[model samples]
Target: VPQDEQDIAGQWRTFVENNRLDAVVCIAAALRRGVLDEAEASRYQRPAVNLHQPWELSGLGQLHEAAQNADRLVCFGGD
Candidate 1:
């Protein structure tokens, strides 16, 4: 079976933390979908996003309050 992208990305978290991968920004949705930028994505099976993907990293500055809550984080709900 193909490895779950989320699951695979999860293990990346440790590296992110140990390496301090706080650089760059991720879209809330992409984070939720298990796409980490060498940090957050690899951390949790659940996403750390609190917003939607449309915000994207580039325009995140526009979503002031939303960006603040980005790291608020959320665990994935089991089906």
Candidate 2:
């Protein structure tokens, strides 16, 4: 990854230590920022949910298809 992108991912990783899934959006931010690649994403099999509104989400439904198929980071069943 580029230095600047790496820097951004590093900062976000710090936040992940603090907020975990809430900070990283079920690994979405990490994936987008290149902090977690496809292989890494496939490793997180736990369920996750964010109660915030649709507009409040960052990459809303980016993982919906995968979630439906029982992949890592389930992203459904919210108001």
TM-score of every candidate: 0.26, 0.24
How would you encode candidate 2's per-residue C-alpha lDDT over 1-79 as one tens digit per residue?
Answer: 7754568656656676666544425546544554443345345542443222211223556455546776466445779
Encode model 1's per-residue lDDT on 1-79: one tens digit a residue: 2554456434555566667654234467565565554345445654454433222243356456555778764435668
Best by lDDT: 1
Candidate-wise lDDT, in order: 0.49, 0.47
Number of the top TM-score candidate: 1
TM-score of 1: 0.26
Badly placed stretches (over 4 Å) of model 2 are 1-6, 22-62, 65-79
- Give every collision pair in model 2: none
TM-score of structure candidate 2 = 0.24
RMSD of 2: 13.3
